[model samples]
Target chain A: MKYLRLVLRSFLRSKRRTVLTILSITVSVALIAILQSILATLNAFANNPDASNRIVVRHKVSITNLLPTRYADWLRQQPEVESVMGLQWFQGVYIDRSNFFPNFASEAEFVNTVFKEEIVEYSDAQFREFLRDRNGALVGKNLADKYGWKLGDVVSLKSELFPITVRLTIRCIFRSKRPADELALHFNYKLLEEGVSYMKGRVGTFFVRVHRADDVPKLIERIDRHFHDAVEPTYSETENAFQLEFLKMMGNYSAIIQMITGAVLVAILIVTANTMAMAIRERTTEISVLRAIGFRTSQILAMLMGEGILLSVLGGAGGLAIAWLLAGAVRGYVGTFLPYLQNFHIDAGTMSLCFHATLAVGTLSTFIPAYRAARRPIVDGLRSL
Target chain B: MSGEPIIRLRGLAKSYYRESLEIPVLQGIDLEIPAGGYYALMGPSGSGKTTLLNLIAGIDRPTGGELEVCGHTLNGLDDDELAAWRSTYVGFIFQNYNLVPVLTAFENVELPLLLTPMSRRARREKVEEALAHVGLTEWMEHYPRQLSGGQEQRVAVARAIVGDPELLVADEPTGALDHKNAEEIMALMEGLNRDLGKTIVMVTHDPKAAHHARHQIHLEKGVLDRTIEVNR
Candidate 1:
């Protein structure tokens, strides 16, 4: 504690250099925090705890391939399954092609059962109305709020994949735990099938809800085996695994992000190490004077390293504050393209990782230079005078 | 200035090496200065007077021969042990008055005491007393850059004596000072020796500064040339 003033004074000796170094670390660490938060958001999307009791059954070929609608009936008849719904992705655009969001043609009657975890709130009467009207649509709260949509508001979507323009009347607006899940709209599959002749008896996937989470594995095996020799083979997995498969289709995003983060960390380490080395080198005479005045080498080394760590921690703290302040804007901007990042914010785990990373960089970058400076012979140091 | 000498040297030798080539700076020398004696070492630039002062102060090791000062065998102590010994027994005032520029006079003087188990209050008190002794109590809050060359040297002197070490070694303490400041610093050193009974060993090329010492030991080419007792 007595040496703190000495370390601080030495650190502040070169104000411009110190501030520049700290800014470098701050910018780099902020970049790292944002990147790690994005990765964490994606991971949370792929590993949602609420998805444990749900399973997804898709065609054996690819996600784009459609499965027979009878597969949902077969899944519902299974003793382990509690509810099943056929879901078909409606790749559509609104007024502008840039205004894109996930729209799905879904079985309306079983939505409340199959996605019980997702539909946090909705009016029972509005849901019944959606079930009755062929053009009625169930919009997520975020999707509705985004487009200023309300009950009885008619919204039209032009689908390029299926030669049809379906005009849907918003009957219900539902909320969900995850923001990404609340950025979607679902209309009755009957409306889509009646408009497009080829999509009438086919679904992109079947989402099944089981009574018990433990029954999911067995139910998935049973469903796949039942359709193994059928005209279209089925691939069944837990909802979490399905989400992970979708993430995989994005081409090893996690590894790419991690590599980029690692590269940034290394670059910051080099810059910080150079700054510390130069600072210590500049104070060669001062260090020798301290040694001559009876300070031990270890004491000198500790003081130097303390200065480096203090610099890094200050930058790290600044970076975190900046990242936190900008998180909302990042979520809104990036989430437009990638819905999974709508829930993007720095989590506790990411904060901890960044904090530890700064500490490691501080310690590692300062060690060699501080040790060399401290271990230098006092006579040699004095000779510089 | 009788009884056993506070500093004793027998065949003290020091050498520097540059890639296997040896450069002998100080060759076989025998010397002693009794307790409370004020002496000066005077020689040419390469006469190795500063080297001898460094060795006696325990800042540098004698590569080949036995060296002892203030009852501790310096040759037997490691770097850390020597540092501990120096904190307790020896004080140094460099040619440049190497007070830490970032620290105030009080903090600079309080540095050596930080190595001890002294409380902050005690350290502050001792620093205040030391600065007062150098007649710079009013300037204790000032930094080295803010002080004149003589005042900086005085702060260096205060830092040297704050720990109450038995010996004080100065390497051209007033080399950078003008005539007036040099005289003032020499007077301060004289008072420290005469009134406080400190053993002072200083290295100086300035004949006027060397005249202030009780005895001057002249060295020529790493060997003692003569010892002259000054008739003050």
Candidate 2:
């Protein structure tokens, strides 16, 4: 305990160097925390297709292929599949063409029943009126924000695949907690079909609400088996598995993150080692003094190592704090592409490893210098002064 | 008058070899120092007075002889053991007053006491007594930098005596001091030898400093001449 006091004094003696080293480590750990947090959050959010008992039933053929307009009605008639809704991508862009949002078509009547508590209603009357009006659409709050679309605003969209111009009056605005969902523009399929007659009776996907989550896998397999030899083969999977497949296409991103973290850790170790060695070298006489005063060689070693640990922990905490705060500013820069930015948390186990690693580096760098200082023939050390 | 000789050296020899040339620092010397006796060694440079002092202090090994201090053979002890023994049985006051620069006079004195199992209160009490013995009671809390040469040397003396060791070794203890502080330190050493019965062996070339000891020995070319006893 007393030896620790002497070690701690060295850190206090040079506050500037200590703080700088701390900032270095903080940056590394913070980057590590932020990267790992976003991936984990995204992975979890995308995988969670079932809030309770939900299943997405896309085309019996390719999801790229359109489903029959009659499927939603057939799905609603089934005892297993409770209440169905169709969601088709509209592929629309804002007037400025710079802002991006999700553009899709779904039944305005059953949207609340299929995905309740997701899209906030703009007004009960306006919402009902939009579902009844053939040329009406509901814009998400984020989309409305992008184009300044008021309740009575009219929006014209240029379709990509259909190659047609579609216009509709904004009847209501929907709000969503999920930022991804908030930036969407939704309209009824009837308006989409009537506007483009060549695409009549064709729907994009069916959202099947099941009573139990356990029934999803079987329902997906059953849905697949029903159209096994269709013109376009169908692929069905759980939401997480579906997202995981796409994440796999990211090709070793997690591995890359780990590599970056490894490099950062090594860099920190080197910095700490050099600083510790320099400090020990400068205090050669002090070590000798401790030895002369009846301290054993081991005590001197402990003192040097203790000093290293303090420097590292100080550096580590400082670096971690700075990294955390820096990540906050980065949120405004990274924007919605990296959500859960505030989820950055310091993991004690990792920090403990850093602490122990620092201690090891301290011990390693000081070994030669401390031993040299301690083992000096006492008369020589005394003779020096 | 009270006990056996606290230190005995028999044919103690130390040699340095520079790649095949054996240079003997101390040759075939036999000596005994009893408790309470004050002995001073005087010699020119290369006389091995410092080397001889180092051997007696257990800081170096005898190349050919047996050295026993307070009933323990020096040859049987390791460096760590010797340090432990030195803290308990021997106190050193170097010529330049080798008090740690970072420590105050009190902390310097408190250093040797750290090795002992004494509580802080006991250590403080003994440090106070040792400093008071050297007449630096008021200067205990002052750092070495703040103290004069004489005062620093006095603090070194207090440090040496703090553990109440069996023997004291002074290696030109006042070499760096002015006449006033040097004589003041010499007087303290004399009192320590005469009154407290500390068996001090001091190495010096100054006759005035050498005059304070009851026994004066001369060493030349690693050999000790016949001793001359001085009146205390």
Q: What is the lDDT, from 0 to 100, of the residue B28 in candidate 1?
A: 90
Please tell me which predicted candidate would have the highest TM-score against the true structure.
1
Provide all candidates' interface root-mean-square deviations. Answer: 0.8, 2.6
Pairs in steric clash, model 2: A22-A315, A26-A319, A26-A320
lDDT for model 2:
0.73
TM-score of predicted structure 1: 0.97
lDDT of 2 by residue, A173-273 (tens): 88876654565677887877877776687776777777777887887787678657765345556655555655676687678877877787678778777
Candidate 1, superposed: residue stretches over 4 Å from native: none
lDDT of each: 0.91, 0.73
Q: For all candidates, state DockQ relative to the true structure.
A: 0.78, 0.33
lDDT of 1 by residue, A281-376 (tens): 988888998998899999999999999999899889888988997799887887877888889898899889989999999999999999998999
Instruction: Give the interface RMSD of candidate 1.
Output: 0.8
lDDT of 1 by residue, B70-131 (tens): 99899999989988999999888988988888889999999999999999999999999999
On a 0 to 100 scale, what is the lDDT of residue A242 in model 1? Answer: 93
Model 1 Cα displacement at A365 (Å)? 1.3
What is the per-candidate TM-score for chain B?
0.97, 0.96
